[model samples]
Target: MSLLDACGAGSSSPATAGGGTTAVLNMPFLEDMQVPDPDIMYEGEGVQVMHAVYDGLAQYKPGTNEPVPLLAESWEISTDQLTYTFKLRPNVKFHDGTIADAASWVAGFKRRAAINQGPAYMVAGIKEAVAKDPTTLVVHLKTPNNAFLHYLACPWHPFAVSPTAVRKHAVGGDLAQKWLQTHDAGTGAYTIKEFVPGNYYLLEKFPGYWGGDVAYDQIRITITPSVSTQELQLQQGQFDVITKGLPIPDVLKYQKNPDYEVPVTLGGTGNAIWINPNKPMFADRKLRQALVQAIDRTPVVQTSYGGLVPVQKGFWIDKLFPPNLDPISDTFDTAPLQALVAKLPDKNVDLAWGADGGAPVQQMAELVQTQLAAVGLNVTVRQLPTAQVFDLANQPQAKRPDLFIDWLGGDALHLDTVLRIMLRTGAKPLNLFSFTYPELDKLMDEAILQPTTDKMNAMYVEATKFVMDQAIFVPLCSQPFPIIARNYLTGIVQDSDLPEVIYADKIGRKLS
Candidate 1:
């Protein structure tokens, strides 16, 4: 059967229009989103929606790490790099018609800190956030952090919330958390029109948005868990775009098809096998090293990902690492691993992949299981929901899986995020195993404080080398996220800094 026939094209009304001021774009997600609250969401799926409905003080330039003026028109850093003063953009209004000013930004920062949820650490370094004037915001950090702007540009960065909305909706001092679940208080180009968890989310263009031109009048995202169903829908004109969940084979087919536009770009995301050090089986450093050496990543990348993803050479993504640094070699003798596995009282190891990962992730997990099994270890593969996989960090050592394969990346392209978020002691959710290295953490802490990029890169290189030696994680493959959209859709550029997320406001229907 042809690939189109295999996808099972079904009949449905088109979700996109060729031309009109009231253009609508329909997209699908394979996973359910958490609450739409900006301060609380840390997942990739939710970030895509939040990015559309919220604007930060600064935003990264599309396809680059450089932070550009967004809500904040401009900013200046103090000589010590500990203080930042931002000049707020004028006449910007939140979706609720409240003015987005310095005071509102300060309130938002305070709210984020007070709530202290998943992505709060992005602003934890700030000692104080004060509005010097209606249009001026002065922030004081405990120490100098050159990457502070990049942090603000991150997808999970704290965003400006409408203080007016907060006050009106505050119930028992929840900071509008309950109201924000199905609502928006942001100053972005889009506003949340409807939110139904595990079903559908609707976003409509804000009429009062300060940002120049709003694109699609409405963004309709439905939760379609099945990739095959999504494929069928996309072919049948039910889904204008399939942002995630389509398997690599189907994606490649879309790339060849004339009716679809498949744009592929590096997602700034990569998968890694995280070893739970707290587990008795992985407690020994030698066993960790043995496991790392036993499994080859080439087959995993080529077979599971169809050679679309490159095998990770180091802990950091290719862009963040210094060019001169030597790549981590995959060549290792498996004899030691085989011997170690044979000696273990319990050779059985539990391996898990995040549920959101879909087919590619499961295939990678199964391949790894086979590789480890070949070295005498009995590996059991399990699929856990993303939230449960994240919960493993807080679970008792006995309750956690021996090893879990998960996507390890950051909202920004900075090495600080790559190291800090995935390996830092307190960075939760993504830091699945709660892996901590005082030396590595110290290096990262120092790296961010460096006055120059070269100095920071040098420090990060040392930290990467240290982590490689420790074998806390088995570096897997990094793949470019593919977005398959109808041919008429325009402005579907992927933000390099925000991995897998596109600027919803920039997307417009192509003129007929």
Candidate 2:
């Protein structure tokens, strides 16, 4: 099959020339130079890159988007979906020439759960990672987690285990998280060679890989902090594979180019303006509505953002949802603004944006202020320092934010990441939003506490609606992610949802 056919075409953007194997990326956060154990990868991008380097018990087939067997020959889950048993591919071998064994898998699982933060909490319910003799590993969960198998397919699992590898470079928190950074213990297609944090990362094809040989000999991921520089590199033939983040217009340069081809994908993340419900001013939906309605998205998107489509729904707004339509640009609609002003506290609104000082937020704050003032609302905009923003965003339930903006892509390998983190009325340990609505919180409680998938999905829809109605956040447009790459890079997936993980697949590059 043709590489384009293999990747499957989409509406967002077109694909590049060459096969979908090789890739070049301008990774901004070059601070992460090591591929930490898949079981312990805290960052989403880290886990993405680790996908190609490490094999999970299950894998997502590139074009088909189906989760199929990889290291594990087959697996079984209880009807409750709480327990999972895997039958390993007995012939697989690690990079160091050791057999991939059940003991190694169990050891990695324990180490992952012991780590304090990130998605490892998914396995908190895992009662056991018992090795049934040698080829079998059975995991028993404390609860019937429907997302267990999917979570296992994530970087957190087919756990990266190294009998001696992780222990060698283990640091700070734990041994497993540290060692996998520079070492290879898994039977993956690629191996790490040079890692200079914040500068660049280099990976080489491993002949010892158990799965199959990759066509590319080397992959270099340089940290091009500037998005403009990345766009230039792709057009200038200096790079291959560009990830989305730039405006649609900025990407047009490459998209129209006949020398090579370029494509864009809608990565699976939803970006929104985070509002702290605890703040007295934002506490009122009227004030929140005013802010959302007042800002002019046209200038903001056309000028600041390149070509990202606008979204009105706070979360999961369907294709049919309206107000923001395609081809026709979005302007600051005043009808909703008038409706909001009528419901306000009858006073002028003064607000502060808690985040690093930026023109975008500053402009947004000013725009909101101007719109409200025309209708007798007073507005004040404050830009807090980055540290203060972080502190406030992470503040305990007792002290929560009034207005803040952030990006939260849908991620719950356990599938509950969204429900458990955002909609908690109850005391969920990881309630980042700290929003407590009797009805909303109760819905979340039911969703997480429920035993069946049917019930779980139903409750999730209800809870999501609650969040939307509450407008705990001001819905903004999702920024477009555009990638540009030079020819010779082939077999690259460039998945929009999780770009970091997509580049990690063993890409093929034909050197001239």
Candidate 3:
């Protein structure tokens, strides 16, 4: 059977009109080197390269969080929702001419579990993955999770590789991980033609790809360390696509230019003030509530975000969440904060943040410092690398900060990802807040099992409200993610399930 016949085609982007030509899609890179192994890739550049060269069981529908079948034609969830059976697309072959089947998936999952690197968290819930038959793949989970399918759709995890090719290239039992860094393997639309770490990489379209047509024959990604250089390149028409790192201020400057199309989209990730309850002053729920209420978000949103992003109404970004889930009203009041602050012996706050969130986090922290001062709180701001802040929080209880301004990159499709990563007991080590409540944990677990959307939303609402009452953290603004494209570039999908990712396969130059 043909590849398309094996795996039923899910959806196809509209073919470019007229006649198309080979176009160069230039992308950016922040890291010095991309981890070539898909199971271990966590950085943005690595993810981009992996998605370009690999296909997961599923992928998010373009511009939406809804999961759609990709390598797997369809999947069935058991009554308990712990077992997922996937029907493989039969004709799918990796770039190396090896068939990708249920066995390939099993091998990939086992490899991911064995490698145990940055993206290891993606498969942490899986109890086992087995090939029930040649085309049938069954994955058994430790517990029922509604979002497990969405997890499979994520670019970071469970993409099938050419196990035969991988094994052939394996050295010292490394599963070809070391070799894959400089090579390509998978059934993605593009194959790596050339790779130079910290410099650039080139992708050529795979002719045997079953995912309809790929507009661009080739994609060249250049390493850009500065946003200014990206902006300059965009203005000079040196690059067709700029994949992130250009600031909002620079995006604003290019908004009026006819040469570029600056798309301002709401990202799935959220920024917030993570309060550490282990600290003496913040241990008081009243004090935490007061701090949130006292701070005015208007100026922070206006100045820090340049009024580009919305002042978050609730913890979740509005685009990805149901409207009813947001708080009815977020009121700013100082009386409660003033009274609470007057009673506290220690009013000094150490605000720590990383460069990941860039100027917005720093500006938001400074604004918060000023806001709390009006209520008799003294704030000291500190800046550190992203790694150090997470390291300190993950260390012993005594090492956590009083408060940290940071961004939470939530799963775009489900709220459970946020709750599981930030609020659950085991998540305390990774989260800024070190406290866990039994009642909240119960609500979270129950919400996971809810069979209906209404019931699930109700439980989630209750859980969110419970967290709001505790005031463990303050939800700030959603980051403004703007994509800059040359006006001649066509077939660019501005919205994506993963806010940080932009698929390179769909890009095509406008046919004239």
lDDT minimum window of 10 residues, candidate 3: 5-14
lDDT of 2 by residue, 370-460 (tens): 6557766665566654334434436664445444444443343333555554555543333445667788756655666567756776776
Q: Write the per-residue lDDT of candidate 1 for residues 1-512, one digit (tens) a residue.
A: 43433332211112323334356677888888889888898887778899889989887777666789888899999999999999998889988887888889888888888888878877889999998988999999999998789889878888988999998998999988999989999888789999999899998889898877765778888988888898877776667787765678888888899878888776567777888887888899998988888778888878877777777776666655643573767676689899988888988899988877778888889988888888888889999976787677688777788988877677676778888878888677667777878898899999999998788878877887788788888877676678888776777877775456888877765553
TM-score of each: 0.93, 0.75, 0.85
Winner of 1 and 3 under TM-score: 1
lDDT of each: 0.80, 0.55, 0.73
Strongest candidate by lDDT: 1
Query: Residue 71 in candidate 2 has what lDDT?
Result: 81
- Cα RMSD of all models vs. native, in order, equals 3.0, 7.3, 7.2
lDDT of 2 at 174: 73
Q: List the residue pairs that clash in candidate 3.
A: none
Worst 10 residues of 2 by lDDT: 319-328
**Residue pairs clashing, model 1:** none
* Native-referenced Cα lDDT, model 2: 0.55
Candidate 3 global CA lDDT score: 0.73
